[model samples]
Target: MTRYTPALATALAVLLPVSATADSFTATIAAGHPPVFRWIRMISDTFIPTVTAELEKSGHTITFDEQYGGALAKVGEELEAVEAGLAELGTCQSLFDPAKLAVQNVTYYTPFVSADLRKVGEVIDSLHADLPAMTEAYGENGVVYIGAPITIDDYLLMTNFPVESLADLDGRKIAAPGAAINWLSGTGAVGVAGNLTTYYNEIKTGVYDGVLVFASAALPGKLYEVAPYVTRAGLGAQYAGSLCANADWYEGLPDDVKAALKTGADAARDWYTTELETAVGVSLEKMAEAGATVTNAPDAMRAAWAKGMENAAAKWAAELDAQGKPATEVLTTYMEAMRAAGATPLRDWDKE
Candidate 1:
């Protein structure tokens, strides 16, 4: 064999692209919820694979270590986990972490706006992409907002007692998650702060008379077993959160790698919205077949419920505005987008 020389090695290096060596990367993705949830499922079934495939095209490979079901970070703590590098990425749930993601919780405060999950997802995802204010909180929290917005389906009231009208809700205790608790205002019902983790058990044990929950989660959590009276109150779909990456780690990645990550998130968003739409119908049907009474609230009652509620959006935005969080901007942008998309709200939340 010929003797090795520095000149020969240098020439070989110049002839080959650095990527020809195939750099490998390891990413740990975290989610508070388990794989059974569609958002988490999207991370595993779509995001990781899409990113891997894209990276492979550039002679790079990535392996994902998925930590879900609060294995790595509990609900409301995912952003902190990713920020601190406990995981490289996570589903930063705004609904649960309202203090940190105040602007992202705009949809939750602006109930009765739209029940279309696709519209809500599209508007919120677009806001994240085009609006700096929408993502400034993420930057401040040491995370970078990516795509894959988690859009919950239209919320409804499920209770053990029959709710025929607003009168039925008088003095009743209803549980709602995060800012959604404000939704019970002027309805004569007592709003209790709660989450999906405890909704079913709480209702069964007389802790809550009902829960304002979504169809996608309600069916899986088996809320129907305890709260058989399903009243479609039209609380509207909401933007709960999105995927985020550790700012420090993400900034250090190569441009190509960064691009791959975003592409994966887009794929996840599409997959999640599609799956959620189908699941909404399936969940409702399955729950009804299991002996739950599913009834749509009359138009008059729906309008009255919306009109009578306190203007939580204005109040919430004002509170965050005092904190310098651009909450009002987010609310206006979202409401305007929804109206442009053909949604006629019972009340103009931003205008009021």
Candidate 2:
């Protein structure tokens, strides 16, 4: 025998425990959108590969049972669907879950904080590090936020009407999805219910005159196929969605698997962001070449709207505070960071 000693045996025993501790877990992710959509690919392909690869590297195995394109949940019910433990995880747009995911909308209230999706995304991710209070809001409904926060590309105005100034926007039927309608509040533009999917059709049918949509999603969605006037209103992108997990499912996961999933989530966030950032430029070019009339919203209008947001921000913050969520902190942190980053608010619709 080479060496049969207690000290050597003890060393081997310790290494054995270390090696034995690595294990894998199976995670199921849910999405209500098609796999071809960029959002879906991030979750099903990019996130899956990144996380599973990380787990395997760390001696953990991760298998995903993915449900996309509403195979598991309806389009708008992702928050509830995830919370009810239907699927282990899903991508949810906070704006869509107004009652449940109210806390995540803090940055949306403080507009122009970041036109750069990546920067806004970083702040949100950093804030989400230990947002148990925020999570508790989700947890109360049986959902948990894991991995990364979801940030959207900047909201641009693709309109049937020409808007160079606030005056041009007066009395026009403005189709704004979610809280973005608040952005058009006082301009005499009627806030109609329209999301990216419906905007182009609504425009074609004369349901609304214009749309507030992001280039990343809209270009792929081809909203310009209906609306010809695409104005670069330059409303900063919002941190609009999140990667949410089923609390019960998450708790059931092994520690190593949980860590692997988180690693995967980070990879997915970066991948989604990279695609979003690239899409913005590319979408605009395609829209421009396709005969969409494009122009920048005037500085005066942007300044005017920025001034009006005070009351809206305060009201939105207070709403969150009443719910016992850290809305004020989230809002304040975002506004301060954006200001520090040289962000000037575009419009002040909350002002009288």
Candidate 3:
């Protein structure tokens, strides 16, 4: 080959480096919930910022377009939106899509495990990594499961009337989110499927006498104004949502870019967990300050409630098992992992 002139070589070198440098990418992340929700807020506050910083270290950068609070997808529509490429990433509320992402609702089925939110989240995320079926559910929906699962604090019974025992809930209507309604089985409470957004209005209007809600959400929704009696039932923490990315889009990313996104998700998990932990105490205090009656259900009542309930977890796993899904495997793995992590479950759904 003929040697290039000095000027030509200089131009070629400049062009070569420019071509070799990673191209910037733009990803749009969506969330159905508003920024007021800690999990959603962490997307902008921690995930985006952390991702930006991590990619910069590799000489690659990404510009994230945040669409939250139903701007792009309404509640329960995030998975479809991401799969259809409406959003490159989003918060997929598995609780809202139990029909499609059935195994992801394990914690909701197995209650009274533990109130340690961080442990619950960590265990579920680990399952997603360790189990093929866990991630396969997302792959089947054309989404990639990011490791950070959104976990909520312990569930409690918020009511207009005092609830010291399971007897207090007899014939009472209680609003509960999907899958969680099963928690009311054998407790004599009529479970009505409801969500946080409508809890206040429904309770105020007497559509339901009470709601199965967590403190972190109740304070923001101002549910105390309507259901002033709060009973800490210790119904257990839950993993209800996760950050996911469009499978095609995620697979097409450069390795470094992909790593950055995962790093961001990991960081967001810690941030969200810390924020949620802090918020729980603050929310309960705020509710109590707002003239709400907050009391802990006695140990006897908590035990009675657990024993009285139908084994929804076992039934749920068996149904999925019949469908040829590894539901029992996942259930066993999850319950074992929880116990290994120092959780003393009220009932071992997998074994029982």
Candidate 4:
């Protein structure tokens, strides 16, 4: 038991009248890939800084726990991790998580459409904001879109041997990511499900003869050392993933904090697309200088390659539509948007 005096009581009264204001927030940002990738790098370089700056204007601060290289989540598992609250936010790779994000893979199913990374990134980001259907999967997974769209540059075939024609791919073990594997149909090539992380070693060790990869990644991965023949077959740029936050965690944030996150994401998107646009040309040039033989497929060969493949888009849309996913609608909308933006697709995936 203790005695309470007037001075002690006054001191306690003065010290205990604290306000219940939250001036800070803590977030854990996860990515399956390491910071070597431009998209991952932008998280640290652009997204975090932009968010911090915006929050500071309103007398708020945020602390971010950056997790990359599968330290927190592996590729295709980020969405689940965020949904389960293992992380507050992550890059939800729709391209890899095709079953969960079927509608998000519309671009992959409809290849040979556009190679413009800027256009694809802008259009896809717009869709995410303007189209409720675009974000339906996120809601189902207990996550919400936070932007920072990842637009892969034009995909090219990098093989150990020269590919002057489609016949060169016959019987060869070629690797592609996710839905893009379907592009191998009617090409006579064996399409192995592979990713950028294992492409260099797999190809070098004879596990794969070649890979359908993009230049921006090929240069950093040094795939030229293994598969030196790079053929620009015009598979087109792709919307692989985007930033997502745990629905509960995001909703709990203050309005200003949420606005800051959006601002950060928009800044990151602009930075990423500009960097990717520059990287495509620079990566190809560097790979060529490093002894990789680079060639563009002939017009006839490109046309034949596109014509030979099965209508994967129609099949994919039909399958998802049967499952009650708005894949067909998303596909049609994407194609219309692309066409309206001046893209001349080799095949009308939605119309046909």
Candidate 5:
């Protein structure tokens, strides 16, 4: 009887393999920010379906465990959540993950860098292709880097007061965080740490005179209602965000799955950029229609603001060096690469 039991168990174990022949895989994706517009919807509506369709053609069924609107994580926590495997993949905002993603901050420091989305996209692809250290950084956090270059529209200042000239900005409270604070320093505009999610309330209560933001986000946030003066400084553009995957999970995927994931990310990047191109123009028009004072920053104002950012680049490098990392080298490499890519950068930040 015992021998029969053993034989039966062995037979059942062998049958397990045959029984589980279904070719289905699950992908868990999370985004912390609310379901606002282009960014969040691109992943949900466009990228996921595109990847799923492609995967199906390869004889695999896919399921998405989507946790959008912060169901899985809070703002600034998406990457960390993905790192912890709370979700399989996610949108990681480098602007928020400063410590772990400082090298990614290269664009943030070098303002007026480039507004051409195609150029920005090419640079990002090149950066991933060239910078193993960036991959290493992502790896350190238990995630694999996937390039979905986020194209931020030109940065602008929207205020309650009409800032016609450099002198008009004097003594105003400007909401510009990180290296952006340097853009407002000595203009008598005090710098405050702020993001799009909170700028409205900040401006409503007079916490800030205006914000250093782009119309793409600012209009949707209804910031124009609070601060009607919109100044287009056109501080070039930037690679604002990225998509990443859990390293262990991503590395463990079959080659086809890996390819599909990349395809999905590329699609997302393309769709998001295209959508943003339309949105930026539309948002500006919307703001104007809503009675906002839209105008360009005076040449002297732009020059004065650019000059104010002189010390910040050096300050960032020194801060990074004091932490015992080769911050200066990273900064230089990025600048050189940008110039090689035909970007005539305004600030030589590495030496600043």
Candidate 6:
């Protein structure tokens, strides 16, 4: 046992008192989707635990009240929920909130770039850090951008009928989500705007012939049941959503709490991406085992589809420029970054 002088003991008591009272905060995190979705699940499985662990190191703690599966907000309402303080944090789907987060939907317009979900996620997350415009967009909507960007695996077309070429899609009704509807332009396919939740019922009732979706979701949603034909169109992976915090709430957080949240986002991104990559392969195999006809769209057909589509990316960027946003600059920067990372895009949206 070590003995201390009265003066030394008094100094120790003073210093110990500082951390004795740990600041505790209550945060409500909401998501439109259920915990079945990988990203939403990670918020609990990875993010909350990681942040809790990190905060403990600094003698701070946060208790998260999870509200997922539309218990707090409906699909496409997460951003608003967070902005209005209905939820302190949320998974904001930029794909759904195109009018509010147009820039964050860049990957949707720039298709055929790369199929690497990890690369797409990291690149977009990096943009949020390097480009003030990226974060500023979220700020304008009353949210602080967190680092983890929820990216999906490569997109494929699932149809009731087989599609071996673009011609097959001619006069066929194809359901696409939000900005992805533009991808059907000049391909002779009639593009109807749709979302994942309605894909099953719509296709089952012939509301539409099929949908443009990804493997991870398609498998779980049992989209293969309605649309048995899976054409790997290589439309490219995409960054659809992100974790964000209410700006006002985030600003009032203790410094250590903020740091822990940031650190948690970073770790969650890594874990989520790895799990996603593994799930993609497994999901595809499972779909095939369930008797879904899975085929890789012929290279020539893919090239034709890319060449035939109208330059929606250019048009989208121009619209943003007209709105006084750095759309063109972002397009260029994104393409350059993709190329630098060894991505060989079939169509350089900015250049052509």
Separate clash counts for every candidate: 0, 10, 0, 0, 0, 0
Report the error of model 4 at residue 111, Å: 0.9
Q: Which is the leading candidate under TM-score?
A: 6
Model 5, runs deviating above 4 Å: 1-22, 322-326
Which whole-number lDDT from 0 to 100 does residue 324 have in model 1?
88
How far is 337's C-alpha from truth in model 3 (Å)? 0.6
The residue pairs that clash in candidate 4, if any, are none
What lDDT does model 1 reach?
A: 0.91
lDDT, residue 90, candidate 2: 88
Which residue pairs in candidate 5 have backbone atoms (N, alpha carbon, C) closer than 3 angstroms, thus clashing? none
TM-score of each: 0.93, 0.88, 0.93, 0.91, 0.87, 0.94
TM-score, structure 5 vs. true: 0.87
Best by lDDT: 4
Give one digit per residue, the lDDT tens place, for model 1 in 241-342.
999999999999989999999999999999999999999999999999999999999888888888888898998899899988898888898889899988
Predicted candidate 6 versus true structure: per-residue lDDT over 226-305, tens digit per residue: 99999998899999889999999999988888889998999889999999999999999999999999999999999999
**Alpha carbon deviation, residue 61, candidate 3 (Å):** 1.7
Worst 10 residues of 2 by lDDT: 343-352
Best of the two (1, 2) by TM-score: 1
**Model 4 alpha-carbon miss at residue 76, Å:** 1.7
> What overall lDDT goes with each candidate model?
0.91, 0.75, 0.91, 0.92, 0.78, 0.90
Error of 2 at 230 (Å): 1.6
Candidate 2 structure lDDT? 0.75
Writing each residue's lDDT as its tens digit, candidate 2 over 1-352 gives 7787999998887777433767656666777777887777888767888777777766666678888888888666887778877777888768777677787787667665557888878767766774454555776778767755678888887887667777777788888877777778666677887776677677889988888888877777778878778877667878877788888888887777778778878888898889888888998899889888878877777777655444577788777788777777666665665666666655432332
Residue 258 of candidate 3: its Cα lDDT? 86
Residue 253 local lDDT, model 2: 77
Query: What C-alpha root-mean-square deviation, in Å, does candidate 3 show against the real structure?
Result: 2.9
Residue 93 alpha-carbon offset, candidate 2, angstroms: 2.8
Better of 1 and 5 by TM-score: 1
